[model samples]
Target: MSGRKYVTTVGVEVHVELATRTKMFCSCLNAPQGVAPNLATCPVCLGLPGSLPVINREAVRLGIVAALALNCAVNPRIWFERKNYVYPDLVKGYQISQIAMPLGERGWLAIIGDDGAEKKVAINRVHLEEDTARLAHSGDNSLIDVNRSGAPLMEIVTDAVLRSGREAEEYVRKLRAILVYNGVSRCRIQRGEMRVEANVSIAPEGAKELGVRSEIKNQAGFNHMRSAVEYEVRRQAGALDAGGTLRQETRGWDDVNQRTFVQRSKEDAHDYRYFPEPDLPPLNIDPAWVAAVEAALPTGYEDYVAGLLGQGLTAADVDALSRNDALGFLRLAASAMGDKTVLFAKRLIKDVFALANSTGVPLDESRLGPSAFRDAALLLENGKIAAEGFRTLLDVLYREGGEAERRAGENQLFVETDAGAVAEAISKVFAENPRLIEDFKNGKIAVRNALLGRTMKAVGKRADPRVVSGLLDQALQHQGRADHDRDTRLPRGKS
Candidate 1:
């Protein structure tokens, strides 16, 4: 343990349930959550005798989209295989999946590495498969709900390229954004629509081979995955340092304890006894279909982000928009708001999204729809409302759907537009702060910001900013010129 260095590595497997209307190989409804147990099941999903499976075209198209998103090469011809395993949740002793020839292969996703440089995470494959049933355990019995069975699931496996928990988290986060942004999946990790498995290992620096690895299964979220990987690395490295040989195994994360515990010996590909699925025929994707999928694809995530950044959005703003799932709403509101897109984005992220996070409400659940957002944004953009007034208007729109202008008028939130009142307010500020005016005359011109603030305060923050600014500038210019004239007329000490 004397200054010895170890390198930790992780390879992650993520499974996302597709958003198709039907199951992967049957016509059963794809909705599993909130449905009665086994209601969405069918003969094929239930694995009844003589029930043949038919591949869903929508699911396949979604897979192609997903593959393209990950920068994968789409395989021209693909077939399914039977992965045999004995599990209570797997009603079919042999689950249908793609192994020998998957929909896509050799994909890579770019992520910021531990060194803070852009690095690519090599992807082994992206394939489509069927999900198993849901299992709920009680005191001594287990309940199996087949509602989730046969749902189309896409699996993305990354090579052992990640060096730390942070990199893994970023990879998953970016991947989720790409899929969700493309309308490929909702990727609600809490609801099990997207799941993660991470393989973690550590070895002394310059070791010939990677030490034995442990597979941590079914982390609930990206943070949980990161935590699990970190813990596994520490545990494995400690064991190796103690001169103990590591063993390959499957493990589970104990969230309450913040640790990983062994589940069982890990299974290899041979252990699954995979073979060509005899019931389903192979699919050949023709050029026309491939072209159609390519056309359907949206702007790449990186490209869209670059465009947003070029439009004056900070990288941090874009990241926040993605995290809050506000990107789609931004797109809609921006298209309607025209040149004011950047301003709207700032208000949405800073004010609205923050409010949502604080109130335990999702952005989608708020009463503020895209149209309502455009209305509120217009009020702010056209200077009918102050920033404070805009926030208030949004608050009302979020809780009670009303016109932005009506809400602003009722709340007395609009800025005062009367020229007489604005002039009067500026005169009052000028009279009250004689010292500031003297300083401004003495070439302390930056004091104008203080003068402007005083003028805005004098109007109860209801004055149009442009009106205050223009009036203040004219008054200051007059004062500066008079000061110069007086100085010239009387030589300082003589006067």
Candidate 2:
């Protein structure tokens, strides 16, 4: 096995459902879930005779935006083609897609490759089309839901550049992040808003030519995609090693068994019987319109992460904020807090996020708005609220949006900042623990922490720990000095 090495080559096709108000070729609602099946259908989407297809302008705009985000060049002339295929999901025996003139071409997305270096994955094309109805099977019977039919869908094809399953997963994750950041799609994989397919093949380590490839269809999640690609790589390698030939076919991933099973023979361009759509006119994208869309694009996810790191955020914190999909909220809170972005980011990642996770709520969906979050951070930074108080205030804000400072005050959660009060608390702790004080003077320095804990407990955790510790150390020092003076005088008298 060590001597027989293989190189895995992977390319991906991603399908994203656009967040549009209506379907691609009809004015029916584009809702896919929680609606009665076959209701969001029309003559245009149902293949009824004599109904013509119309293009959705908003979908086209979103396609162009997504293309630009991936660094693709928009084609000046965009046209739709008819792809003929027979499938239960595709009601129209033929699907309207693009082959010759797509919306954009030659785009690239950056991903951290398997070798721990930044690598760019070449995108062949990003095109717009209509989605098909969904098929649900149960007990040897199948149900069709046309609510998803005719919904605007964007298909992005990548060049065969990925080298491993990890690279493929990272590419998809980064792509999904970009899409969601730009408000292009919800990208809810569980709900089928986004789907991924991997085309994988393996060749000898130094082979100059490629090997036969298999298409893995509709991996619902990133983990599933990675697993399927890796399994196929091994399966193909084993077949080649056993003097068995490989075939071009489509396969489905059985997540339960963690393997890929054959679905059908793969089809090429000729099999689709491609031709231009007769109803819709070719789209002539204006240069100015393209410029406007490009200008409107938000900052890329990588750049945003870099900026946050530059602002003194730890890599772990950035990853947390990104994975939780709270970067948008972070940006808003940062803007509200001005130069204290790092402070806010830390609190959000540590405190606010902890609360959200423990309660099974997403941070972005919580009632903690930017203003309230900013105020809480400021309170913590200024020493007006102790750690416990800050956490309590966060809970209040998460449940009901209100002024942070006011809420803290209402709950008596403010830090005990009075020096006299802290001194009194320290004195009481020292008096109650005379043995501990004696132990401390005899060089049992660890007792200092115990004394400090007692002091905080006495103060109801309202006094800042740092302040309490300082006061305790000062009182202990004074006591030690007085004891030293008394010891010296007594020694002379006894002599």
Error of 2 at 13 (Å): 0.9
Q: lDDT of model 1 at residue 125?
A: 95
Between which residue pairs do clashes occur in model 2? none
Candidate 1's TM-score reads: 0.75
List the candidates' TM-scores in order. 0.75, 0.75
RMSD of each: 6.6, 5.7
How would you encode candidate 1's per-residue C-alpha lDDT over 325-405 as one tens digit per residue? 777677777763345778878888889987797777777668887778888888878898877678878888888777777
| Residue-by-residue lDDT tens digits, candidate 2, 1-495 | 345889899999999999899999989989745668898788998989999988988999999899999999999998999999999999999888898999999999988788888899999999998999999999989999878888999999999999988899999999998887776787888878899999999999899988899999999899999999999998998888888999999999999999999999999999999998998889999999999998876567677788888878889988898787777677777763246878888888888889888888777567888889988888888888888788989999898778998889898888887889989888899889999988777777778889988888988757787788888889888877788887842111211
lDDT of 1: 0.86
Off by over 4 Å in 2: 1-5, 205-208, 332-340, 358-495
